[model samples]
Each structure stands twice: as structure tokens, then as C-alpha cells.
Target: MTVAIVGAGAAGAAIAYALRDADADVTVFEKSRGVCGRAATRRKEGCRYDYGANYVKDDDERVTRLLTEELDTNGLVEVEEPVWTFDSAGEISPGRDSDERKWTYEDGITQLAKRLFAATDATVQRETRVETVAREEGRWSLADAADTVLGSFDTVVLTPPAPQTAELLAAMAWDDDRRVAAHDAVAAVDYASVFTAVLHYPFTLDRSWYALIDTDGEHPVGWLAREELKPGHVPEGESLLVAQMGHDWSGDRIDDDRDQVLREAVGHVAELLDDDRFAAPDWTDRQGWRYALPDGGVTGDAHRSTEDAGLYFAGDWVAGEARVHAALRNGFAVGERIVEARNAKTY
Candidate 1:
């Protein structure tokens, strides 16, 4: 069997790794240059920081074992600091006191997907965007932006966000009710926009907690985390802060100038920490996620509907939460389902 996966994030990588030992030829397509979609990391001038997801929390035993035992390569470490929350009024307080363990790699969170991909035989084709998919005689065919044929596969899994998946399906000329139903259900899954500003300072910042979250939605800032807390993320004697604007604020100025967004983020962090020095930074970087995360996952009906056409959906969106662990879990489950389906065909 031949398999083609779109989006080489956690979910897609998990699926490919699970099928590595199987009698299948797997290929993964990722539009971006790197993997681990939102659980992204950026580096500059000997400094690295996770500007997307801060870290991965091990809530599921399987995920725990995967990180702790299976993929326990070098540099896997736990974050000891607790997460604290701040209100719209800028009052900082203790947040969730869960005993769950948070895990990250010294290189970056993108190492997770990189490790998974390395453990698999799947060919990861980065900077390749799968534009269309077609089904013919029980086999699946895919194309790129210029309508060039990629390949025909026994199965194809899509791991992009719900909205993107829906758009792709809708644009395709599939006449099955399953495709329509799946597209509609996935289209219904709304997403929250997020604007992130990465600020680098000349001096190290002193903070009681690793990160500060806004408990109340009355503030322009949604989250602020000192990336230097993760050790190795910042150069010694320097600091890096990742500030994310609230959904409302992000949606409003998602297309605004990067300078304006950085200015607002600096002001919010300055007020929150009561430090006037935040007004200036040694350097800055920015990224805007239009579909940062889905508000909710697709319904069971929507999931099953896509399966009718040798199509599978996997992502944090399918797990109803925008977390790395959830996406991995979903990916594992979807991979198992594909393996079973392939075996059934053989019989």
C-alpha cells in the first residue's frame, strides 16, 4: 500500500512513524520549510525560543511513555516551574497546579516532530503544498499548486487545521456525500487568530513564574512568557519574551503593521510587569497565525464521513483541543485505523 500525508506536524508525523514498519510506502507533504506546525521554534544569533507552543504536557500515559521512554533522546527535559496567570487588571496569581509533567527538548519543540520523522521511513517533502486530491478506482491521487500530479496512493491523510482541510475538500471535484458532509462539519469548526511578538532584550529578566496567562478576557494581551526560563533559549545575560495578543485583539490587527503590534505588546507587558524598561527591546520578531487553533473539534459524524473515501483527518482540531499531546494521540489512533483498514483490504 502507498500512503500520502499532508501536513507533517505531530499528527502526520505520528501516523507516518506508526506505519514505518508496515508494508507501505509513505510520503509526507509540508508547505512549510520545517515540521511541527504550531509547535514551532525560531532561532537568531545563538538564541532559540519556542514562539508557538511553550511546551508539551504529558497527560496521557501513552504520550508520557513515548516522551519519557520511546523517544527519549538526548536533551529531553522537564520544566519545573509552574505556570502563573494574570488578570485583565494585570494582577498576577498562581494558575493551575496540576501535577502533570511538561516536556521539551534543548534544541526546540520542533525536535519532537523531527524525532518522530527520523524514526519513520516516510519521505518528508517540505515546501510542497498539496493543492488538490482526487479519487479514482479506489486509489487516491494528489496534485500540487500548479496542478502537477504528485502521486496516487492507497490512502491519504490530511492533518492541516479544520478550515484548511474543508477548503481543500470543497475545491476538489469529489461527488460523494461523505466529502460534502465532512467538508461542512470541518468548515463549521471556527478558529482563533493569534499574533505573537518575540522580544529580545540586552539584560536578563527576573520573574517569579515561567509564564503569565490572562485569566480574564478584558486585556489586549492573552499570554506572555519569558522564553529564557527554558534554559538555552536565550543567551546568558540576555532575555527573550514571547507575547501573544488576545483573540479579539489579534483578529482586529492581524493585518496591521508588525511595528504597531510589537508596540502594543510591549506596552501590555510593561504594564503587566510594572516595568517601564519593556518599552524598548534589543531586537524583535513577529508571526501571525490566522488559524492558530480551532475553537472545537469536528463531530464524530464528520470524522466518520471522511473515512468513507479513504480519507482521514488528524490534528489537535480532531482532539477538540489545541495541544501537542492531543494531536499526537489523535495521530496514533488514526494511524492504527489506517493500518487496520489496509489489513482488511489484504484479506
Candidate 2:
């Protein structure tokens, strides 16, 4: 049997990883040049930073074991400092202490997917955007935007954001009520927008916490983190701050001029940190995630009803959480279900 997984993000990668020992051929399609989706990483001028997701916390035991025991842990690093909290009024306070482990790669957070894909025999096709999915004669067919046939598979799993997945289902040629139900359920999952600003300074910053999050969600900057806390990310005596603007603020200026957005983010960061140096970063970068975080999950029965038709969905939205661990867990569940179905048919 053959399986085609769309969007090589954390969920997609986890699905492939879970099916590594299964008796099926798995092919993953990714629209971008790189994988890991929102848990992204980039390097610039000898500094590596995770601009999309700061780090993955050990919220799930399965994911924790996968990272520490199952996978190669060579470059794995943990943040020692705690996360502080701030309010809309810019009043900073010490957050509650917790023993949660924050994990990331010394190279960057993207290594999570890269490592997962490396351990599997699955084929990863980068820069391949699967535009259409069609079911014909009990098999599934995928095509590109220009109607170029990619391949036919026995099963297809979609791991894109809820909106993108809904769009794909809407365009698919499968005329089944399950498809419509899945589409509606997936479409109803709302997302929160986030605009990230990477600010770099030539000097170091003295701070006790690794990150500061907006507790009430009313601040312009929802999250601010020091990339230097992650080993091998920033050079000594230098600092890099990852500022993620609040959902409301990001949605409002998502399409604004890039320079203007960066300026406003820098100003907000400076005021929040009470440091004028933060306002004048020596270098900067920015990214706009229109569908950064999902607010809700799809109706389980609606999506599960399509599984019998060799169509499945897995992602953060499907798991009803915006965390990377949740996405990985959901992918594992979906992949295991597919394997079980295949085994049952053989018996």
C-alpha cells in the first residue's frame, strides 16, 4: 500500500516517523523548500534563530521520549531560564515556576522534522504543492497547481492548517458526504495570526528570564524571547530577541509595510524591556504567519468519518491545541490508525 502525506510540518513528519516500520510506502509533500512548518529556523550572519516557534515544551510524555530516547540527541539543548509574564500595561512580573522542559536543537528547531524524516524510509518531496486530491477507482490521486499528476496512493493524509486543509477538501474531486463534513469541520477551526520580529543587537542583555509572554493577551507583543538562551544560536556578547506580536495586533497590520511593522515591534519591545537599546537594533528580520495558531479543533466524528475512505487529517488543529507536542501526538494516532486498518485488511 502507498500513503501520501501533505504538508511536511511537525504533524506530517510525525506521521511518517510513526509509519517507519509499517508495510507501506509513504510520500510527504511540502510546499516550501524546508520542513517543520511553523516550528521553523533560519540563520543569518553567523546567528541561528527560531523565528516561528521559540521551542517545544515537554508537555507530552510520548513526544518527550521521542526527543530524548528514540531520536538522536546530539545537538539537543534545553533552556535553563524561566519564562516571565507581562500584562497589557507593560508591567512585568515573575511567572509561576514549573519543571517543564523546553527542548530545541543547537542548530535550530527545524531539526525536529529533519531528524524525524531522516530516520524514516519515507520520501520527502520539497517545494511540491499538492493542489488537488481526487479519488478514482478506490485509489487517491494528487495533482499540482498546474494539473500535473503527482502520483496515486492508497491513502492520503492532510497536515496543513485548518483553512488550507478545508480548501483542499473543497477542491478535491471526491463526491462524498464525508468530504463535505470534514471540510466544514476543518473550516470551522479558527486561527490566530502572529507577526514575528527578529531584533539583533550588538550588545548583550542582562535578564533573568528567557522569555516573557502576555498573560491577558491584550498587549501588542504577545511573546518576547531571547534567542541567546538557546546554545549556539547567538554569538557571545550579542543578543537576538524574537518578538511575536499579539493576535489582534498582528491581524491588524499583517499586510502593512514591512519596515513600519518592524519599527512598531521594536518600539514595543523597547518599552516593555525598559531599555532604549532595544529600540535601535543593529539588524532585524520579520515573518507574518496569517494562520499562526489555531483557536479550536475540528469535530472528531466529521473528520474520522472520512478515514474509511482512505482520507485522513492530522495537525495541531486536529489535536485541538496549538502546541507542537499535541500535533506530534495526533500524527502518531492517525498513523497508527492507518497501520491498524491495513493490518486488519490483510488478516
Candidate 3:
């Protein structure tokens, strides 16, 4: 069967890879230039910025095994920075003292998706946005923005956010009940918006990540990551700091003057260290994720389609929380369901 995976992230890639050796053909459609949806990366000048997920960790042994390849323990660093929290009252330090492990992309977060995408025969079409989808004669017809007929397939698997999936299905009125039900399920979670600033410095901070003071600043900054500590992320004697602006500030200043955002970020870092000598980055930019991450991820109903057989829907959003493991778990569930449906049909 020709199965279409509507994303190239962890869940989509996992589905494709699982079905690769199975009795099915997989075709993955990615809206971006490459995989790594939330775990994305950007290249600017000579440096690569991990604006999305900085790291991933899992207690699941199988997943840990899958992601731990091609790198060593030295490739992943333990975050020892004592996180300091500040409110209008005063300050609080919730330190991390356990053996907590946060895994980063030895190169950048994009490597995770790249590795997964490479495992399957799935055709990843970048910059190809699905404009519409419809069902005809038990097959799915998907069209792109240019009015080109993308072709028909037996199964359509969507791995984008629940809201986005619902929007397309709603716009097409494809499955009114399923669409409405999907929205109800998706509305359960709130997504936080984050803005990051990548700063290149002349020296390293000797720490993999730094805990910044999250005070009452207009989009108070979260952790300040020294990217140089991540293997292959930076050169010697150079530092890369990634600062995260809180959701409230990001929402308020979503369209604020670009200069204002950068300046505010730099100032926050300066205040955190009480230093003026720390040079502002020679490069600065920002990105907005409409559904950057779920305030909480809740499992929605993942079952047979209301209109067609063998069709399935899965995504990280189902987990009611955001993380690499959540995507992996969701993909596994999707695979299990597909197998069950296929087996039932054969009987």
C-alpha cells in the first residue's frame, strides 16, 4: 500500500521506517527544507544555531539505544548549572543534584531527524505544502499549493500538530466529526512560545549550559546555553549562548521591533552575570513557533478513520507534553495500530 506520512519529524520518520521493511510503500511530506520539525537547526555564517530543541533524554532503554549512536557520553553533557528562579518577591534556586542526563545533537538537534529519515525509503518532499486532501474511491488525493496533483494513496498519516491537522481537515470538510473531535482533543493543551538568541563569544564559560535569572523582565529569559560545550557545535576559544525568552514576552513582542528584541535579550544576559564586558553576538535573529511546545500534551483518540480504512493519524501533540520520547511513543502507537488494521483486513 502507498502510505503518505505528512511530516518528517520523529513520529513521521519512525512510521516510515517501521513500514519500510513491512509490506507498504511510504512517502513523507515535509513542509520545511528538511526534517527536524521542533528539533530544528539553522546555519548562519560559519555557525549552526539550534533554535529549536536543545537536547533530548529518555528513560526508555530502546529509544536511548536508538539515539545514542554515532556519539559518546562525552558528546552529551550533564547540565550542572543551578537554575535560579526570580519572582516579584525575591529569588529561588531549584538546583539539579541528581544524575540527570540531557542529550544534545553532537552536531545540532537536526541530526536526530536526519538519522531517522535516512533509515527509510520515504521520499521527503521539502517546501511542498499540502493545500488540500480529499477521499475518492477509497483512496486519498492530496494537492499542493501550485495546483499540481500530488497523486492518490491508500493511507494518509498526519504527524503535524493536532491543530494544523484539524485545520486542513476542517477546511476541506473532509471529516466533520473527526475534525471537530480532533479540535476538542487539541484544545486541551496550551503551547508556549519561545524566542532564542545565539551569541558567539571569544571564550567559553566552562559550563555546558548556564542558568539565567528569570526575573520580571519583559519576556524574562530562561536558561542561557553555552553551545560550545556540545561536541562539534563550536570551535575552541569560542562560546555560543542560547537565551530563551519566556512565552508571555514572546507573545507580547511577537512583532516588536527586531532591534528591541535583540537588545532586550542582551540586556537580560548582562544583568544575569552583572558584567558589561561580555560582548553581544556579531549575529542575532529570532523565530516564532505557533505551537512551539505544549503546555501539556494529552493523548487524543487515535483509531480508524471515520471515512476510510487503513488511514491513521499520529503526532507528538498526543502526549500532552513535548519531548523526543513523546514523539517516539506516539510513532510506536501508530505503527502498532497500522499493523493491527492490516492484520484484521488479511483475516
Candidate 4:
């Protein structure tokens, strides 16, 4: 059997890992130069920061075991500090912390995908954008944006964001009601936009919390975290703050000039933290996530209707939660389903 997975994000990586020992050939396609999709990381000025999804939470038992036992724990670190809360008025308070374990590598959160793909024999093609997925005579074929045929496979798993998945389905050369249904259902999934600003300072911040969240979802700055809280992320006597603007704020300014966005973000951070020193940063970086978080999961069984046809979908959107663990767990479930189907010789 052969399988092709699209988007080398957490879900795609997890699926490939789960099928590593299976009697099948698997290939993964990623558009970016790196993997892990929104669980992204970057290094600048000797500071490493997770500018996307932050860290994975110990919300699922299976995922916890997979991280702690299955994968290498060499650089694994747990964030000891708690997360506090803020309001629309920029009033800060404490009390939303939990016993949930927030896990990330000393390098960054992207290590999750790196570690998973490392354990798999699957061929991961980076900087390769799969623009087409067509069904051909009981099999699937994929093509790049240049119309170059990649390969043919017995099964295809799509782990991109729902909007992109919907586009692929709409353009696929398949004549089935299930295709239309899946496209419609996948297209209907709403997503939230986020604009993240990375600010660097020459001084450190003394705070009891690892991060701060907007409890009412009415604040311009939705989340602010100190990168130094994560081990090996930032140097001593220095601070790096990741400020993610709220959905409305992000959607409004996502297309504006980058410099303007960074300046405004700095002002917002200063106001939120009640520190005039934050008004000016030694250095700054920014990333705009147009489809940062899924508002809800896909509706109806359209996604499952085509599974018997050797097509599958996995991601946070499919799992109904915008978390890395949810995407990974869903990928594991989908992989197990495919393995079971193969065992039964159903496909």
C-alpha cells in the first residue's frame, strides 16, 4: 500500500509516525521550508522563540505518554510558571493557572514534528506545495503548482487548514456527491486570525506567570508570553515577549504595513504590562497567521464519507479543538483507522 500526506504539520507528522512500522510507503508534502505548521519556531539574535502555537498541553493521556515515553526526552522541558489573566480594560489578575503540563523542547515547539518525523521512514518533501489531488481509477494522484505529477498512491491524507483543504477538494477531478459535501463542510469551518509580534529587550522581566491571556476575548492583545520562561529560549538578563493580537485586531491589521503593525503592537504591550520601558524594544519581529486557529470543527460526516474511497482528513479543525495535542491525537486515530482497514483488506 502507498499513502500521501499533505502538510507536514503536527497532524501529518503524527500520522506518518504512527504508520512508520506498517507495511506501506508514505510520503509527506510541505509548502514551507520547515514543518509543524502553526507550531512554528524561529531564532534571531541568539534567541529562540515559538511565534505560533506556543506549547503543547498535557490534555490527552495518549499524547502525554507519547511525549514522555515514546519520544526522546533529552531536551524536553515543562513550564513551571502559571498563566494569569487580563481583561479588556487591561486589568491584570491571577487565578487561571492549572496543573496541566505545558511541554516544549529546549529549542522550540517545532521539535514536536521534527522528533515525530525523525522516527518515521516516511519521505517528507519540504517546500513542495501540492496544488492538486485527483482520483484516478481506484487510486489518488497528486500534482504540484507547476502541474508536475508527484506520484500515485493508494490513499491520501490531507492535514492542511480547512480552507486550503476545501480548495483542494473543489479543484479535484472527482465526480462524487461526497466530494461536494466534503468541500462544503470543510469550507464552512471558520478560522481566527492572529498577528504575533516578537519584542526583545536588554532587560529581564520578573513575573510570576509564564503568560497572560485575555479572559473575556475583548482585549487587543490576546496573549503575551515571555520567551525566557522556556529553558534555553532566551539569554540571561534579557527578555523576549511574544504578543499575539486578538482575532478582530489581527483581521483588521493583517494586511497593513509591517512596521506600523510592530509599532502598534509595542504600544499595546506597553499599555498592557503597565511598563513604559516596553514602548521601545531593542529589536522586533512579526508574523501574521491568516488561519491561526479554527473557530469550530467540521460539521457532518462528509469527511468520513470518502474514507472508504481511500481518502482521509486530519487536523485541529477536524478534531474541533485548536490545539497541537488535538491535531496529533486526531492524526493517530486516522492512522489507526487506515491500518485497521488495511488489515481487513478493505482498501
**Residue pairs of candidate 4 with colliding backbone atoms:** none
Could you tell me the lDDT of residue 318 within candidate 4?
Answer: 100
- Per-residue CA lDDT of model 2 for 247-347, tens digit only, reads 99999999899889989999999999998888899999999999999997886689999888889999999999999999999999999999988987751
For model 4, residues 1-347, the per-residue Cα lDDT tens digits are 89999999999999998899888799999999999999999999999999999899999999999999999999999888999999999999998898899999999999999999999999999999999999999899999999999999999999999999999999999999999999999999999989999999999998898999999898889999999999999999999999999999999998999789889989999999999999989999999999999998998899999998999999999999999999999999999988988888744
After superposition on all CA atoms, what RMSD does each candidate show versus the true structure? 1.3, 1.0, 3.4, 0.8
Candidate 2's TM-score: 0.99
Candidate 3, run of 10 with poorest lDDT: 70-79
Q: Rank the candidates by lDDT, best first.
A: 4, 2, 1, 3
Backbone atom clashes (below 3 Å) for every candidate = 0, 0, 5, 0
- Candidate 1: deviation at residue 148, Å? 0.8
True-structure lDDT of candidate 3: 0.67
The deviation in Å at residue 113 for candidate 3 is 1.1
Model 1 lDDT per residue over 166-214, tens place: 8888987678888888888888899999999898899988777877788
Whole-model lDDT per candidate: 0.86, 0.94, 0.67, 0.94
TM-score of each: 0.97, 0.99, 0.86, 0.99
Q: Tell me the deviation in Å of residue 104 in model 3.
A: 2.6
lDDT winner: 4
Q: How accurate is candidate 2 locally (lDDT)?
A: 0.94
